[model samples]
Target: MKFLEENLLDHLQRPEFAELHSVLINHKFSKGSYICQPGMGSNQVFIVVSGRVRVYLGCEEKEFNLGILTKGDIYSTHTGTFVQALTDAVVLMTDVKTFRQRMVGDPEVTKAMVRVLGNILKTSFTIIDGLAFKDVNSRLVALLSNEARRHGMSLEDGSVQIQIDLSVEQIARLVGSTRQTVSMLLSDLVRAGLIERPERGKFLIPNLSALESVGGVTLS
Candidate 1:
């Protein structure tokens, strides 16, 4: 199974999950589709099998993105938040009751839950820190630095390239800024030799230290 290959369902793969296999609802959402919204029932848990989901807060006029989750990531909320598909996505959905029942017999499943919870805690703190303390430029730099650490391709010249195809509007939403503000800051970053758009859809950090200074950050 693809879940086995990706280790997505690793913890839940005990014999217990066999029963769930028959009942799990598999659905696809086009990009910009809402997986769930505020006031929606919170009884279901969703696990992404493909593509990406954005978890955010606020109304249609303005949004503060919490984070983005891709393949193998999971989400559920007791008080539901706004979750929308960032790309056309395949997801598995099941009632929280069914999911909890499956966890009863598996120690590994509990451990997986702990791991996921820890990550959620950490990410929550990071988001809070970004929103409370960091300026828009700093937040953008932090976002870019995070991408570089996660997906950068190191070039021979000690620079790093990140193939982030996000639009300025998307990036603005992520950093809790307007597109115009992000665009101006990006231009400043470019002028300072901090970041470059090497191609149409990629960003190159020619000097990591310079980029960090501009963002007032130091990524460890």
Candidate 2:
């Protein structure tokens, strides 16, 4: 709680922002809580103060885990409920409509937010390009590469460990593949000593080079 304030309260110090932040509420979710569903009216922007969130979209009633959002990330009830905590989590919640209005009212906030919307646009393009041109394994590999670039931690082994652990089913959802396919790929990767599932549902990419088999990623 203190950390949340320390990190955010300063940046959100404007009188308008204070008013906006004040209206924001707090929510806690137990592990495995289904926080969002399709067709629900969403009105809040959520900032995780602790723990992590899974943001996703769905098709024909099947949900896709788009990405894992961690602390300091901001999300709103944009289309349906796009986010759900993966563990016991705390979030600072704000009314999205009101906040959007405020952004319209303040040029500073508006520009800052427009930048965000632009990024979403860019990601939508990425999704489109990926779906059309990439194979399931290639997509999964690229997604992991992106995740590692952002959230991976340096391990003593000179490889990086992505802290956001996920099951093959979750990975399957992200890559538009079935769990059976993900299981096969994962097993093959493990058997070849290219990756190690040192713990349940978690893979340690001890070296980035191992992911090269998935190929065509521009890692820099």
Q: Which ten residues in a row have the lowest lDDT in candidate 2?
A: 1-10
lDDT by residue for model 2 over 51-105, one digit each (tens)? 7777667776555555565665565675564566677888877777767765555
Q: After superposition, how far is residue 57 of candidate 2 from its true place, in Å?
A: 0.8
Per-candidate TM-score against the hidden true structure: 0.78, 0.80
- Candidate with maximal TM-score: 2
Residue 77 error, candidate 2, Å:
0.5
Candidate 1, residues 107-177: lDDT per residue as tens digits? Answer: 65556546555655665678689889989989999888876765478999999998655688878887889
Of candidate 1, the 10-residue stretch with the lowest lDDT total is: 1-10
- What overall lDDT goes with each candidate model? 0.73, 0.65
